[model samples]
Target: MTEITADRVGGDWLSAPRAQAVFAALADQGFAAYAVGGCVRNALLGAPVEDLDIATEARPEETVAAVEAAGLKAVPTGADHGTITVVSEGEGFEVTTFRADVETDGRHARVRFSKTLEEDARRRDFTINALYARPDGQVIAPLGAGQLEDLAARRVRFIGDAEARIREDYLRILRYFRFAAWYGDPEAGFDPEALAAIAAEGAGLTRLSKERVGAEMKKLLSAPDPAPALGAMAQSGALARVLPGAVSESLAPLIHLEGQAGSGPEPLRRLAALGVRADVDLRLSKAEQKHLARLWEAVDSGAGPAALGYRFGEALARDALLLRAAALGMPLDPEALSEATHGARQSFPVSARDLMPERQGAEIGAALAELEARWIASGFTLDRAALLANLRKK
Candidate 1:
């Protein structure tokens, strides 16, 4: 088992002035405060921590007062839920008081403020995530004695009853698969109870808004080895119900292809690999949908550099080609990629203005475009004068 020391948890976020201030304020108010949840779990794993969350024993009102007194801006983002967003120097830290779930609807939880770390840990999802680190560098583990053991064991066991936890929030069903994809060990396989609970609550996922489901699903599919989770979803019949896509029979090669392509992380290509339609209103904006549509076209057309440059922008064309290579399970040929990128960057040999005497207006533009296409087809060998000559002949 991998043991996490206090030094392992020290990073930019934990050491930030704002975060220190919040800790100091809560300490001064006689409240126990600590960084908890994914932040702590990710810290131990050396993963990038995007958000810092602090759980305190102080009440919401007291927490706000202490934050304001510490010269920080506190917004009552979820006062009823004992949570607030505290801003310091333009960065936001989500501060939530220790709370226990009073009631749950398998989608939303009604939580009540608590004063003990144990109560707070009891309300969380997974054992690894429930571990906490105090400001004094002491780790507080309430879920079980061996939080690090469970994490290293590659287990996704719940803090308590898997069914009760899944009942608290159906999104946990998807989160289970997502977290597993990113962190679980493939050799260990999914826990049977966790899998069964996820399957049972999968249909409740339909109750979630498309925007929420879309976000989670996209993240899930973007993982380094999303195939396992996707395959599990397909086997459990979850993808067909929540997502508007076909769960492909073969996704392992596509996942491996994604790792090979190494392109920018646009979830659309991954989603498309799952046989999803980009233009569907899965809660994307008109502009976003249009861009996805263009991406789809560029990937599907199998167009060369010139064709892609005209259809999509030069950069997008390169991205489309890379994603296309991934989807097709073809190795990313460095020579081909380099040639395409260089070709996309090269300027056309001639423009319509150069054909002023022979061809005029839109026809001149059309002629020049055709000449450029020929020049590109000839591997950029045709000179400007030759392109103009070709245009004139046409």
Candidate 2:
């Protein structure tokens, strides 16, 4: 494998003083250190790289000492797992020692730190994730055959034997689908070997913690368009095991409607689009749960934008309307979308105080409720005096 130089990376962050300092500090200590995995992959794809993780031949202690010697803070965030978080100029980068798994219980692995980059690369989940790049601008593809080609094609491939990789860590199963959704070019097709492994080892997914599974599902759903990757998961039976009741068929059209509305990636909206509800493993927040409840209710009742927005608030109502629009193949109405986003914020003029004293206790409640219903019926146009007059007549 040849070293891809810094010029190739081209991103300002790649050569930023903070990033280069990480590489220089480790190199000065005679350790082979390079920005590895997602950082390298995203940089290659010209995407914005968030975290700058480094793979090195140095041990955890050596890494900590090096970063501290370089006038930075070193935190052993995952020392037992061969990871040290090095903080430089307020930016933290994970510097993990090269490691190979000695034994695995599917959830956690017992790894032995090593000096070879190839060993570290081999242990990685995917080929695109295994590329390592030095600050000096050299990239290495150690164990992944055809890795460079696969990466160029935006192909998400499991490294080595797919089943063996899954056995090492069941979490990779979800990661595979997520990476496919985020990075893979669907037109190029998916790997059959990977799909087969997922189906065969589908049972292992239950062994993973709910938080882990839920986190991956959230990221997968948040993709710009997860339809194709989700379609593959649905076909492979993986989706059923993970989400049991999730309906993926509506996702494709739903995504199209979202795009038409110029919407960005939203996890809850995507999940609502599928019209799935369950006590499955995915951990969603209380607010998310409440919104989905209202979303489906509006979706099922075929509520118009105004009603949806009024009940669920503009953002959620807008998403629900778009999901319904996509499901029904109705043309996306910009005015309706705008209405769903802004028009539902109606304020009725009638209040309990206006009907109070005249109608006491339950009668007052009934009067206020009746007037409010009439106000809603009139698109919230009726004023306090009109409702009071109507209340007196009633």
Give the best candidate by TM-score: 2
Off by more than 4 A, model 1: 1-8, 15-17, 69-71, 88-91, 248-251, 261-264, 305-314, 357-362
Scored by Cα lDDT, where does model 1 land? Answer: 0.76
lDDT tens string, model 2, 287-319? 877767776777776667776777678887777
Off by over 4 Å in 2: 1-7, 300-302
Each model's lDDT comes to 0.76, 0.83
Q: Can you write out model 1's per-residue Cα lDDT over 176-230, one digit (the tens) per residue?
A: 8888888887778888888887777777877887777777877887787777877
In TM-score terms, candidate 2 sits at 0.94
RMSD to truth, every model:
2.8, 2.6
Best by lDDT: 2
**How many Å off is the CA of 104 in candidate 1?**
2.3
TM-score of each: 0.88, 0.94
Error of 1 at 291 (Å): 2.8
